[model samples]
Target: MGRAGRKTVLFDEDKPHNRVTQESHGFITQDGVKPSDFKKRARTDVQKYPSVSIKEKRVEIIEKSGGVFRIQTKEGKELYGSM
Candidate 1:
């Protein structure tokens, strides 16, 4: 969506990787890559888009009324988005 000039927000809690000792396979050129390294590189690529943003907060609630979306975060922040 960011590539199409739409605003995109990604919410991540920054949890630890469960596959720390495993290598990712079947990803073509990224075969045998570490999970942490792959995530770091993917995040870097996503952040390069000006229309994309990353929020390091857990979502508490999501409600849709009328034609708008209301998002509430665990940290008491509220955001609104529309289609």
Candidate 2:
């Protein structure tokens, strides 16, 4: 979305897949980077774009209609987006 100059919202909850698991490997310049650090760097990069925003809440449901997507969060907030 950043590449296309479109505003974007990223939902991250740090689920099980993001739990501490030592070091992450197999990326070109980021091999052996700590998982937490890697995630921080990724978030930082995304934040570099003023059009990008991050949401730390878990999504409860997502529905698509009329070429738009409506997402509901566990906190009872709803978000809508269209491509």
Among all candidates shown, the one with the greatest lDDT: 2
Clash count (model 2, backbone only):
0
Candidate 1's C-alpha runs over 4 A off are 16-21, 25-29
- Compared with the true structure, all predictions reach lDDT values of 0.87, 0.88
lDDT of 2 by residue, 1-83 (tens): 97577989999987848466787888779877888889989998998898888999899999999999999999999999999
| Candidate 1 clashing pairs, residues 3+ apart or interchain | none
> lDDT for model 1, on a 0 to 1 scale?
0.87
lDDT of 1 by residue, 1-83 (tens): 88777999988877855555577787779988887888899899999999999999898999999999999999889999987
Query: Which lDDT value does model 1 have at 48?
Result: 91
